[model samples]
Target: MNAEPRPQESLSGKEISPTDPARFPRLGFLLGLVVVYWALYFVVGAIDKPYFYGFIYGLASALLFAICFFTWWWGNRAIRRSEKILGFVLIVGVGVLVGKFSDRTVNFFPLCTLGLPLVATLVLGWLALVKRSLISSHWLGFAAAVALGFGVFDLIRMDGFDSSLKTHLSWRWTPTAEQRFLAENAASAAAVKPSVAKTVPLHADASTWTAFRGPNRDGVAHGTNVPTDWNSNPPQQLWKRAVGPAWSSVIVIGDRVYTQEQRGPVESVVCYDAATGQQVWAHDDETRFDEAVSGAGPRATPTFAEGRIYAFGGTGILNCLDAETGKVVWSRDTKNDSQGKPPMWGLASSPLVTDKNVIVYGGGEANKSLLAYHQDTGNLAWTAPAGQQSYSSPEIVTIAGVRQCLMFHDFGLTSVDPATGRKLWESGAVMKGAPRTGQPHLVDGNKLAVAVLDGPGVSLVSVTKEGDQWKVAPVWASKDLKPEFPDFVVHDGSAYGFDSSIFCCLNLATGKRSWKDGRFGRGQVILLADQGLLLVVSESGEAILQAADAQARKELGRFQALNGKTWNSPVVANGRLYLRNAEEMACYDLTPRRQASIR
Candidate 1:
């Protein structure tokens, strides 16, 4: 009865009839707008020349927008039977494009292109099932598109695709097989050599620092009565010459002084005139290697033996050179065939020549442990089961009436039958350091003292024979005496070596610090007992001559010889001292006759 029988209101707000084309058109237009906007967004993103991640992001945006549009369009077309299939095809086509784009950028981790599309598909599929409307079919279409996109991306990211892409992009960076072979051969060639006759020694009595620790490997000079006190100036510089970079010490057989140096790509075994420090001859071969901790060149001291010079490079290249000429006799690349990867500080262990066999720590398996190669032919003779490879050179010592080769390995100290590579006995002396670099010196032919740098202090092991078996026991252990470069020398019942910075002396019998003072500044030391002095070379190339006493540290002389660091152990022979830095070599005669002496 009131206002014109007011308009009748229905519960269902506006009846959306399936037969109404206008309502469906409006929905289709809305869906199309969303699709167009998404496509535009993707196109704009792709224009920025994006990398993998950016490309994936762009594809995702485009796919999302297309999904929304298709879903709305599906709602519009589902009402008309003829337009439904067409709407589904369009949605599927849009999905396929999204999937293809997603595949192009899957290399980006976590934010995977395929992952998002697959997730969107699953989510849309759920939403579609929840709503049984035409919009639901649209979501299903979107899901299908995402799945297709994911599959495309997966296929494109496969190994085969990568291979093809690499082939297409191959350039000079891709090394040819021939180039690789040549490089490999060059590395292997370090082990081969030409033969040269050894020059007769100028004088047999003119001693040289033959091996690492000189004649006895005990850091003791035999029969050379060097005066303890000089008049005013100790000695003179006979001569001085510049050598290449190396940490190797000098080995003077007679008139010639041999050592290893790095020129450029080759590590050369250089021989100099002992009297004048003149460059005599150098055997250069290309065996270049880059190291971070240790300097480039040779680390092992050249062993002058049987008319041949044996040298080990920083890269584990062992070369036998002619004593006179710079000709190579035979070489062996321990890096290629042996399990011996060069130590972190480089191969510092000099080759030990015993009888006719040249012994070295090859770091091979148990069968090829401490290798004994024929000195003449470079042929493998025998190998002992050395537990671990050591940077310390093997010392031939007669322990307890039996001649044995004493060597240090990663596990501990070991003695091997020098004749047959047989293990005589091994003391379970665990070094706190992972790698043992310094050679253990024998004290009075009865006790052995070894120093480790990184961890664990020095230990003196006494070797004794118990019936048929040899026994070694820790006499004393001291954490105070840590040597980073070389082992301490034990003379007159005392151990003298560098401990981090301070030069220390300890009693061999008791690991007690007798005296620890006079910081040598983080360097390695070589004890010259005959001269009654300790030759300490600091990391800063300062050569110090001090008294071999633990009670009172007395500095006799000091001089800075080189510009670079001096990690090389100095060699003193025939009253002349040889020192080397990374780029220069110097010789100082500590005799009363020379002009420039230790002043």
Candidate 2:
């Protein structure tokens, strides 16, 4: 003690004590690293694909930064080492546990989202409270911080955030809101007025939109009659109804609209009266596939062809149901018969119905991934090899004037003869981590446009046959317009889609971006080729109608369609526009006379 007192005045009049420590140096370094790390990560979103995992990682870094700051701020004080270590361990361990248990329907990840801010509140509060004892103040600060954090999260997500978390923790507890509201009100709507049962107007005698994208599995709604303006004469709200959580799009056939949803533990194949928004029928299966990011329910749209609905659940159950009443005609579980397991995100491929068979892709590599069942019977028609399945639905397109089934799997693009299941051609393009969820867009006769999450870019390929041998060669690749789940449509030699979160257009011939604007999250688009209108259903639930022009982007009109992150594709049948998300669904009458009647 005497020696220390002598050194206190010797070192340039600076205090020399074992307990005293400088805070700025260590604190500054840690802050600098946190700033730089976040800056780089922000850049990653702009250049590469913007993902949900990236947001999670950013939150983790924020929590780590808060911990480091707290450690340094209290280093010079009389702090307990055991308490500090225990606090950090609890923060990390609790976050990991929360993530591990969270699911699409029942979400607890909000706790982890608010974790760092809560930690900051505790640390700052402890530092400010000078009268109390260090140990008591620190513990008190933590309790207060947690309470404040919960309050803040609840305030931000006032629309059923607590209920969602409760449902996740306890499966028996049903989260109530619009989903229940719509279910209860649907009966009233049906009782008030019966559905007219009108036939969907046809253009060029094309098939009804009974599949994922449209009749051809392309995003084009041929010969549609949509109004060009929504300023003075807005769209007439035919009906707005509540729907369960699911990314499946609405497919219209005759007077019914078919989709898939999660009703508690059962995955339901639901059909509603298109005119009245009434629940016509629903067939339930004791299967549920949950993902925290994508939300719960089946991801595949129910396919309707020839008075039958081919419904595929997220858990790999393929059921062929009767169109009139939702009764199971035939059922098969790909997970049971096929050797492959469900992908991390679950089975998302929509069933493709051909003239004689219903085709779907799932597990197994050796001719088992792509399973084709006979249309009339449930017997296996054929099987083809798809390296590792992607979430993308199999599409039937006539490439090189030959009818073949095209599938973009984890490996790359694969084309197989639909009748024989023979591999006609395979592309060298590879996808890593996230699967290809976007369906391939048919450019022209034999050309194709493929967009995956993190591929090299939006790739253009032409399938040609030379002397009975099929070949797939790339025409161009553009990194400027990379789509994750948002599918692009090629109209008049131009491809349009959401480039990450921003909507972009690219020249199909040159593979050069024309312009990118309108940040619409990961939304979906449908082109009314006859009207030259592109109906864009934004992820945040806005309907934007833009001119399908290659020269420049022209947004003509816009309206609020729904209220959530909408990944489901919009459907336009007759003069009615149908839109939905995980929460609700709406029908807007795009008929000119109906639109004029709106006040």
Best candidate, TM-score-wise? 2
Question: Residue 310 of candidate 2: its Cα lDDT?
Answer: 91
Q: What digit string (tens of lDDT, one per residue) describes model 2 on residues 1-599?
A: 35443222111123345444321122244445445654754565455345544555656765665566566544623334454566556555655554454433324544644445555555445444532332333354554554454434332322322101211222323544435755665566557665445465311235367788887878888757766768866688888878877889988876778899887778899888877777877899998887655557788898877778899899899999888867889998877656777787788889998859888988555558888889888788888877676888889888767898988887777888888788888885555444667888777788888875226568888878998998877888779787776788888889888887788889998989999888777788999998778999887799999998887789998999898667889998867899988788888888766433321
TM-score (all chains, Cα) for each model: 0.64, 0.82
For lDDT, the strongest prediction is 2
Where does candidate 1 stray beyond 4 Å?
Answer: 1-206, 227-231, 364-367, 429-433, 453-455, 594-599
In order, candidate lDDTs are 0.63, 0.71
- Off-target runs (Cα >4 Å) in candidate 2 are 1-49, 52-117, 131-207, 364-367, 594-599
Report the lDDT tens digits of candidate 1 across residue range 90-124: 44554555445543323333123234434444434
Cand. 1 TM to true fold: 0.64
Error of 1 at 213 (Å): 2.3
- How many backbone collisions does model 2 have? 1
Worst 10 residues of 1 by lDDT: 159-168
